[model samples]
Target: MASKDSIEMDQELAKRLFTEGATVVLLDVPKGTDFGIDIKSWNTGENFKGIKMIPPGFHYVHYSAVDEFGDIAPRVGFIHWFSKSEFLVKRWDPKEEELSSEPVPEEIVQRLKDNLMNLDRYLGPYPYDTWKQWQELTNRIDSTIIERCAPVCGYIRSALELENCDDKSRPRGAETSRKRKRGACLSDEQKEQELLPDLKPKAGTELRLTELPNLHYPEGSTPAEITKHSLDSSYTLDLLLSKLKQPIEIIGELQLAYVCFLAGQSLDAFEHWKLLVSLICRADSAISVRRLIYIEFLRTLEAQLALIPEEVLYDIVASNNFVYHNLRRLFANIESNSEVDARLKSEAVRMRDRISTKFVWDFSNLQEEEDDEAPVVVSLDAE
Candidate 1:
């Protein structure tokens, strides 16, 4: 009654279906291959009331355990098509990519193909071109599972276009978020470090600003004030987090940028750099303002205490991908080659020494020194 290949396909499908958040599994998984998916929620756990809800699910059907191998995020949902006789696996990224096609593991691909064909009996039509395309590409690669019996030739050409619309409607969903917020602002008090009990922990802990001994900040130094309580070599890094909470709306914030720079957190710095870019957009004041920020940003990167590498720092900040963010002709340093070289280097060295002396090295001026070298240069040569 069963072709051996079809029977095997059915078993593997059963395993995936049962293990994937299935509370009431009607089918059983075979021995070996375990769950067939190592799907992790990658979340701590779920938070919901008794009405009952499924976790944002994941399927761990990794193409290879090695890095850079395959599409690993679990398909949020599965659907069957009768017309094309295929099954569709959907992920969140809006654009469908061709990369996942090549590196998929043999067993999983075969499993998906066989399961898709069977869906025709129970489900309705699927697009022909998309199905065919998937087949043509996969067929070139053989399934080694038992000499690869029957390869379904797909007449479809479209790459798999599956998206979970449900997830897109969730609160944090990017596409719908702007429409919902209506430029009002993030509603959660957590945005302002003012969330209630259930949310307080999840909002992420407020980090203590590390005080680097030498760094100084002007008044209204709340970010810097927090840094006051910190231990050694810690430049207060509050501004980076604050910007994410709410934009400064001015010509960005030099204090925030400098803080991020001193902390050597590139991701945080880049994000704040964006806020400064926004300020550039509003640069209704002066073109020089934006250039000043860029210059200062570069100066921070060049400081001796900086952890970010010059090449990477350049790639991230210098890429004009963020050009529109510049209003005050942001990178004057790049244009005025001589001026930038002189000014930026001088400031960088000065700041580097200051940061180093206050944090790592400290000394007092003392005239007690070896005078032999100075005398040799001063008296005999001059005379």
Candidate 2:
């Protein structure tokens, strides 16, 4: 079924990639250990040394240590921007059972380069099938965003890095409750003892994400103004945008959070992604003011929604989820607002229809439901 020209073009592209793409020379990794770059993953074989023919740009390299019993540890990964024909070397630490932190000597790296042909058989080709999707997901992201958002440890872990809490790090007023029913059997020492310090995440393990502004109304607002701002988050959105160097960086952050969640399995990234979505969707007035942002937001959101598993989009018991509610609100706001740019409005409508068709979600009654119920106010104040 292949045309001669098309087949020839494919061959030519493959040849170019093979000759010009980057290489990562990982050494001494266990045969059964999990190894991956970007979206593709595989168990390392006995002869596996590293990956080759990686198309130049950003890539996330991740792996999990496996035990003899076949139990796997939490996944850990780092993002790196590769250059064409660049050769990088890393070695496994047998004692630590992970990649060594020490840098490879230049002389040794040169020697490996000298013997590169002999090592070619052990290298795996990069997975090309998911490459396009990965690029779309990360198009807005770049080196600056990566440096700002990545964890200080320079890697992401699926599991939180927790450590035992010291006395100084313990919470104040953490004593055991004294209240008890009369005649209840209790240990006197247990009742008097202060609660133990809770384990906490290691300092450098946390991602340096941009902090989201509070969703509540600004200080000194009248009751009516508070209610209005609460119904629409455009004011809060402006405040958040003011902190960013460019409005487009918000999209970059959104992309970064998504890759961290999808590839690194970070729940923290998932939470951040949800917060960003909520903020963007609630900003009704922002659609007209930031038309470019809304356009990119819709495009990015559509791509992300397609990749998300169906189970995450809806809940059988709950009927609908956070994404459903927020998206419905967004569509209702865009449809009702006359001030929104025609182009942005059209894109919003197209996205709404696509989502409705794909997910079988009915947006027809969203405006009616919105009118019937009071707008949900997300208060930052604690009770």
Any residue pairs clashing in model 2, and if so which?
A: none
- Weakest lDDT window of 10 consecutive positions for candidate 1: 44-53
Per-residue lDDT of candidate 1, residues 1-383 (tens digit): 98999889867754544333222110111111111112111211122101001111211121111113432332221111111112223221224321122233556545644664353232211122232332321222222210111112211111122233343343242334235546556756635532221121111111112112233334466644434422111122233323332222121233333222322232443455555444333222232323454454444323322443456546644674242223213232233334344554455346445644643422222222224312222233444
Q: Assess each prediction's global lDDT (C-alpha) against the native.
A: 0.29, 0.84
Q: Least lDDT summed over 10 consecutive residues: which range in candidate 2?
A: 173-182
Q: Which candidate's TM-score is highest? A: 2
**Every model's TM-score:** 0.21, 0.86
Q: Over all chains combined, what TM-score does candidate 1 have?
A: 0.21
RMSD in Å for all candidates: 24.0, 5.4
Give the C-alpha lDDT of model 2: 0.84
lDDT of 2 by residue, 267-296 (tens): 889899988999999889888888888888
